[model samples]
Target chain A: MSKKIVIVGGGPAGTIVANLLTKKLKKEEASVTVIDKTGRHVYEPGLLYVTLSDQDPKGIVKDEKDILNKKVRLIVDEATKIDTKRKMVEMKSGNRFDYDYLIIATGARLCPEEVPGLKEAAYHFYTVDEALKLKDALEKFDKGKIVIGVGGVPYKCPPAPAEIACFLDYKLRKRKTRDKVEIHYLSPLPRIFPIESVDPIVNKIFEKEGIKYTTFFNVESVDPKRKEVHSLEGETIGYDLLILIPPHRGSKVIEDSGLGDRGGWVPTDRYTLKVKGYDDVYAIGDATDLPISKSGAAAHYEAKVVANNIASEIKGIESRDKYNGKVVCLCDAGNKAIYMIILQSPLVPDGSIVC
Target chain B: MSEEPKVDRLIDARNTFCPGPLMELIRAIKEAKVGEVIGVLSSDTGSKRDIPLWTSKAGHKLIGIYEKAGYAEIVVQKIK
Candidate 1:
């Protein structure tokens, strides 16, 4: 009997592994099935360019059919729950699929509702629509205080807030409104960039770019009527325009299925990418509670390791490939310079680099 | 063949972000004549590869790519 491997999610990690598995094993050897709600694969990082209206919104995504070749079977259904014990997956459309092995790559989702008055007052910079809205607000503003704050902790792309802050300086300057636009950046983290080496480089650029930033301000709530965001410590920052990086959580299906940790992220073996407490089950990408930057590049690397290991398991061979916690991010600090941040085995001693 | 392919539109997308450069190329292509070549200068790291990929995918021809000190100029001719 041919083995069945079901991958939950169609994000970068899921899509990559599905392609790899099909290419490695013949259809008669093992079959592959992918489950995802939306049949579109979005290049999420491109949304930032769309915000500036430099890119078309329609160009950011590709149809799932185009993403995965016809060789791969795609179930355009949302997985509602995964019963590891029974080795079965249930979908929202009331369909069930059995799998000999499972890979969960359902990435994180934003939950801006965690903070009161946020949805009404501020714009979350995660989606294409929100980014465009912020861009529109930027275009209309001639001058005023713009507060770009981090809602809480564990958000995607930790440096994105700083990038926006610096980019605002350039954007406003290009419009000859530099002197009028006062950009202030606030984040809950104790420092600008969590990596010690990276924080100073970012701070230097922030200082040179004239962006006023304050760290350790955990936003507690927002007051749209007053046009202010209040921190947990009762500190408040007034804004003419507000851009927020909202808190993120794992997918609802992962949380509902009791497969997630306290933060709704899946618990997996750091080196092997195997789901903790279960055999023949693995997790990758943003959904896994891995101590690494949740970025697309990182997910691509994780997919390679996961696919190789899974192929080994099917062939009854010992797998040698392991997921090294390495995350490399490239940032353009608004025409000044491009910097790269490299963090390797961050949970271990002395394993981070920033340039 | 003309050395420059009769450059018609010049897009100054330098210092802009990714997809920004690509978008500028697409916009210029849309406004230019079918055979006119559009040139875009971009500092985004992704543009060098992205522009070429997009040009091929859109059924257009990439005229040339010139790399400067900090940025690159990608030229494409709208084929269809």
Candidate 2:
């Protein structure tokens, strides 16, 4: 029997899973259709390099048609609602897709406005546009108190804030303005990183780069007009320039479909990558509230299991691979120090990063 | 037939994404001696244009580009 696999969102997880299926399964066995609104695949990890002036922003984006396999039918449309019970998806464009199996990998959507005045007060480097904007802003910035704020917990790319701090130091040094600038960073967690083995190493980096760090400082609000940010605990900090990683939520389609938690992140079985209570449906990448880092690398791992398991079921065989929540993060601390951390996570079973 | 330019180094960048292949080629070129032929295997669609552009910009010699199963082998030689 042939299968219709409809993958929503052509980000890392969807694109990789679609590629795996199209490459592994015969065209007669399955038809893969991937639907995404943007139809552009951004290598998000590379966005850091763009901010550092090491990589071109254009280099990080790949056309969806170029990355997805030729056999995979690509649709550039917004997935408005997913009718899980009906095994169908309703798109904003009014197209309907029926799926024997579905994979939701829409990833996170940044919500800077969640923090009062943050949308206007600070620059962000999460999206291609935001990153390019930050690059332009940095180029004009010479000497000032620079602040990198982690808006809240459960943001994408755990090491990005620290990396940005170090990269800024490196940049300032090159500009001969190191003495004129002060870099400060804050993490919602108690430490710089969740992994025990990686925390101390990251601290060494903070010390080496001379960047100040404050732990357990979850941002509560910002006063863009005053150039100040207040923590949840009421601690206030002033900055000349602020770069923030905003709080993010899962795809609205998942939330509208009532398949996600209050935070809008879908719940998936950590090991099998299957959406809870949805035997025919699976979720991967930042879209799933998996107990691991919400990163492209982790999505690559989860996609392997989802793709393989679907293939096995279609072939009437047993699946052998499962996701173990393993995440490998290469934290690029400027000055050629690339800190590496390998861990089994979301840091703890409760999915909280307990420093 | 003219003998194919001898490749002193071959980089299998297949399965590696954008910037991955380019970064690897850069490292190989840095380690390579002048006049050494370096061949980079990339599956990334962007490499065809990226590598050649980099080669020209970096003052390296681009020998030839060969298509193979599932990837392209971009051959270049290190110069001054």
Instruction: Name the best candidate (by TM-score).
Output: 1
Candidate 2, residue A180: how far the Cα is off, in Å: 0.6
A183-289, model 1: which lDDT tens digit per residue? Answer: 89885544566554467888887788788877556677999999999875447889988888877788999999999865688988877889998879989888987
> Interface Cα RMSD for all candidates?
19.3, 18.8
* Alpha carbon lDDT of each predicted model: 0.76, 0.79
Model 1: clashing residue pairs?
A: none
- True-vs-predicted CA distance for residue A96, candidate 1, Å: 1.0
Taking the candidates in order, what DockQ does each have? Answer: 0.01, 0.01
TM-score, one value per model:
0.79, 0.78
Error of 2 at A131 (Å): 0.9
List the lowest-lDDT window of 10 residues for candidate 1 chain A: A345-354
For the candidates in turn, chain A alone yields TM-scores of 0.95, 0.95
The interface RMSD value for candidate 2 stands at 18.8
Candidate 2 structure quality by residue, lDDT tens digits, A1-355: 6799999999999999999999878988999999989999999988888888779878999899999989999999999999988999999989999999999999998888778888888898998899989999998888889999777656787778878887788888888888888998976544665444467877887787788987656687988888998885447889999998987878788889999865688878767788989899999999986545678888888899888889988888975687755555666766755544444443212332222
